[model samples]
Target: MTPEDLQTALARALTLAESGLVAPGAADGPIDVVAPRRPENGDWSTTAALRAAAHPSGRKALAEHICDHLLTLPEVAAADTADPGFVNISLTPTARARAAIDAACALQPPRGPWSNAGSGPWSDAAVDPNVIGALQLRHAAACRERRRARAAGITTDEADSSTLDHPSEARLLNALAALPGAVDRSRRLRRAAPLVTGLSDVADAVEEWLSRCAVTPTIDEDITARHSARLVLVRAAIIVLAAGLRQLGAAAPERI
Candidate 1:
């Protein structure tokens, strides 16, 4: 199904819940459906009815009732009603992947960064560059120290090296340090979009690249590099989308 179709179905489901057609408290909270971090959980599962069933009736009956209503939707491939009223809805993998891609593509460019330069909702004026610089230097030193310790046959904590000491982390820090000039360059690029249509096309190209990467079963080093490059664009898109949604007083779901 398309993103709009899935959204409409979700809206109808919410309306049904609001009208007491579905169990009470079933549509509440940040996420009613508990999406699994790993793909193995069959896309999305929810214990909303199970949690709501604690009222007059028990969970089992409530779960069965909710499942009955959900089974009417074509997008739902299968609805497994568990004991204590848990309804697990599984969608077709192809459909779910398409929905994800569509959502990513719907994102608009961020409100000009300068719009948030001063004070507004969600301001970042308190950020201290000196403190950030100090932290980066200390983190770089710690990484060097960890490498030395490892070379000396010490059993250093792997977590620190894996995260803070990673080469990518250092590169990211360097990038942030040089972001002011980069922002200026990006603004210039935005203005020159007509003249640089080929480069402008790269941003539009990101969504398709992300979709391809998402469906790949296994990625080798070369493939990984290409995916990583595309992901940088994808992340920028996410930040822009999140910022826009926040401005519109809507909550963007956290990325998995």
Candidate 2:
């Protein structure tokens, strides 16, 4: 089944357990579903019923009910209630491959901006030169401080200088400072430029910041204009990660 489909089925089963229709603690079982260690067994397997049985009645019966429900799904070739109430499921190979492909495709480029395209507040409204200047100055000062500490031969366990010593950090700072100008230039050259080319470059800059600064992106409407600009940079970095996962034939969940 598709990831969404599997998730939905799991949710439904959990709900049944919570309502006491199944054995107590079934909802809290260690394994949601299990796959066979040996290929001869089946595509997937589960000991959820056995785990649930530790608590209460009709565990085997409840497992059979769950297996019956799973067997109704198109992707499931068959589902059996094994000895001691195990639910083993065999998936159709075509269904498995299709699910994988859909997941990979969902990770493809330009998943779109974090900004809502409909009527709402635009980020440009909050941009402030003064705040941007202050942030830049603060970063520059920190870099200078690290350099001075290194020059003075002040070595301490608390002060790990490897990152600060890297030239890539300097390049990232330069890129961050130039982002506004680069974005502006991209807008001006819209007619001659590729649709997402400049945006991709901005994404690269954000990735550099993430690798160096470890900042997470958020969608806060109340943030200052300067912080909002940094949020845009973070969004670009997320897009880069998504693109990379797509190229690698892997899927990144929307809410990882």
Candidate 3:
């Protein structure tokens, strides 16, 4: 699931958990569900409960209650309390696969998520010839190349994230899932810098995955479900990056 999805779920859980303690509007702030810096922490974590708690003494209890509600979600596997008021969540592999496919499909024909139309979030911003802009263009080109390859049937099998066992695959999926939320957050704040940084993180994760896994194996026998799943992730990343770059008033050229 995307971070925004998780945030919405978390907010609902928090509201239910905070029933009598917090007033109706007290817990109406943005709920931030971010990828933990440390891998061992979990797929995503949030400290919104801490801020929502009426008193410091009840933070732990509120966190546990919210986690209890979060665990009810089918997409969620585990929701554990950490640091008294923080909740670390782990999504099911199937949910991850579904999320990646949803992202990829959202960019396909008809009306896609990323629009090249005039007057958008970044319409007022200037796209100068700076390093960040250059990097965004390069990544956009790479995404286009990858999407072209995917459309050519380099990955024919359906995406099955359950087959994804490599650490790189996990990291890539996690990064992909977080991109939409980051873009939304950036748009809400009316700033392109955070989205740019988030794109860099996704790029770094892609680089790491490429360094360790083969998206298109040379030998036919070596092609596996893991590779196909990775391709889905690549496609997802492509659309997300394209959407974010478009919002920044940048061009994702068909070729570099």
Candidate 4:
């Protein structure tokens, strides 16, 4: 599931809860749905309830109420409240896989809200050279992943959600799903830093997944469901990183 999808679910739950809890204008602004700092917390989490709660005493109740509604979403497998009004949510693997495949299928055109990035007389005066270098490395890694997947005889058509059970895979999928939200936040803040950071974070997740999983089996006969799933996950990450780089007015070259 994409971050926008989760954010919409959170907003709906918040609206429903607010109606009963007397929280006025609670969903007025963009609600930030993010990867939890700790995976055990959930696939994603949001602090909208804490911000929406009219009073400190109401935060926990509002969070719980919102989660009650969050559970109703088809994509969400579980939803629960953490202390101080954080809503942690886990999406079904099926949902995440479906979204990842969809993203990979549309990789060529690249997705948007990219219009907000503008046809600017852009400058690098405020840019971080380290961040740019990191992005370049991610571009190179994605290219290598593409090559590896091809060598393994895995393609986008083989991407099956039923086999996507690896923890690292889940982390990478969630990071991909969160890209649009990261882009939006960057646009809203009028700074590319958020988007740069998001891209870097996603790259880190990709590396982590790669380190733990073998996309290319040592033997042809060893190819399995996990390999196919990993291939799709790689493609999805490639799509997202390329799109983010484009948004920053950087070229995401095939050869880095």
Give each model's whole-structure lDDT: 0.39, 0.43, 0.69, 0.75
lDDT of 1 by residue, 116-188 (tens): 4322232223324343333333333333433443344333222121122222322222222222333344345
Per-candidate TM vs. native?
0.38, 0.39, 0.79, 0.84
User: Residue-pair clashes per candidate, as listed?
Assistant: 1, 1, 0, 0
- What stretches of model 4 exceed 4 Å from their correct place? 18-20, 101-107, 110-126, 188-190
Misplaced by over 4 Å in model 3 are 18-24, 107-110, 118-154, 186-190, 218-220, 249-256
Lowest lDDT block of 10, candidate 2: 114-123
| lDDT score, candidate 1, position 166 | 26
Task: Please provide, for model 4 over 158-251, each residue's C-alpha lDDT reduced to its tens digit, 9 standing for 90 to 100.
Answer: 5567677677878877766666666666666677767777788888888888788787778646677777777777777887787777766777
The CA lDDT at 240 in model 3 is 64
Q: Scored by Cα lDDT, where does model 1 land? A: 0.39
Q: Which ten-residue region of model 3 has the weakest summed lDDT? A: 115-124
Clashing residue pairs for model 4: none
Give residue 6's lDDT in candidate 4 (0 to 100): 72
- State candidate 4's TM-score: 0.84
What TM-score would candidate 2 get against the native? Answer: 0.39
lDDT of 2: 0.43
True-structure lDDT of candidate 4: 0.75
Candidate 3 colliding pairs: none
Off by over 4 Å in 2: 2-4, 14-21, 28-31, 53-57, 112-256
The top-ranked prediction according to lDDT is 4
